[model samples]
Target: MAIDDLLDEHEQSERVRNWLKNNGAGLIGGIALGLALIFGWKWWVQHRDQQAQAGYAAYAEAVKAIGGDDLKQAQAKVAALREASPQSLYAQLAVLELAQAQVKAKQLDAALATLKQVAADSPMKPYADLHAARLLNAAGKPEDAVKLLSSYDSPSALEVRGDALVQAGKLEEARDTYLKAMTGMDVASPQRRIVAIKLTHAGGTPPGSAESI
Candidate 1:
């Protein structure tokens, strides 16, 4: 209400207007950048969610195609899913299905090729490797089968490895691998009997006290 107070307030208002004139653009730019970042992050999340949903939908279609009458069409769908979403576990599963379909159709070479690629790229290495190795043996490439199975450290793969080694003419090694497989297997497992039979084939005799099923 006083003259001095009014002058002081007017001066403060003027100072604020001057600062705004000089600095407003920078402040506005900074605010715009922050808003852009927030919206951009939201957009990215939404985009990823959409992509994941679409990938799942495609995978489902591929799976359904497997049950249909057209085996080749199903294989194509699965292959497409793998190409579109190679990093996805669903895609890896599709690759497995496609390879098996190829196998049933007597497309052994193509099936092996698909399995090999899946083994190289998939996170499910153990299953993929096993499938590939078995098919390699069936394709009469037992040396390659043994080589591929060697990558697996899991006890379950030892049985397949032993079989492959046997076919590869490594009788002693096959017997040893089968013995190791037996150690890892449950006593009552039917797999134990199969391995035992393989061990017998390698050398008409079980190692030490091990019994053949």
Candidate 2:
């Protein structure tokens, strides 16, 4: 190389060394932080997946025990799952199953208490409330059932509320609730037909029915 070219190359090398000397610690720290974040994310994902798997396994055991008529074992498995992973979907399902088993055993009060264990913020909470309302209605607490379902406006909720109203001797409100329940249901839906029967029994005419004409 010519002298000028060699001098230029040496200047560039010196500049690079100076830059490194000034920023090397920061550069190393940035790399370490990046690697730590990457590994930390991987660990979090793996831990989450393992917890899900464990919850699923525990739920399966609970279901198997329920199927085998071993209520004690089923209850134990469900308790373990709930204690270990209370917020998990599998834990919610297992608890629901336990409540169902309790209901089938004619332990209505126990079933209601079991249903209450479901998280209020869970997606399954509405279903749990519906079940609890039914139990209350069956236990001759129709007014309580109506109060329990007061905040819900879903079709199923409305229908259950109507039933509770009817039992509570609020036929007019029951009919109104049944009409609301049938609002979006297809004309040919079996559920609509059932609701229509309830409406008629409540001394109200079902809309679109011959009596309503």
In model 2, what lDDT does residue 36 have? 100
Top candidate on lDDT is: 2
Residue 172 in candidate 1 has what lDDT?
A: 91
Model 1 spans with C-alpha error above 4 angstroms: 1-45, 119-121, 204-213
Measured against the true structure, the TM-scores of the candidates, in listed sequence, are 0.73, 0.91
Among all windows of 10 consecutive residues in model 2, the one with the lowest summed lDDT is 204-213
lDDT of 1 by residue, 1-213 (tens): 766576777798898999999999999999999999999999999999999899989989998997677877987898788788777888888888877877788888888877766746567767978888888888789898888877675667898888888888989999888888888877878878777888898884654464743
lDDT score, candidate 2, position 159 = 94
lDDT of 2 by residue, 115-134 (tens): 99999889999999999999
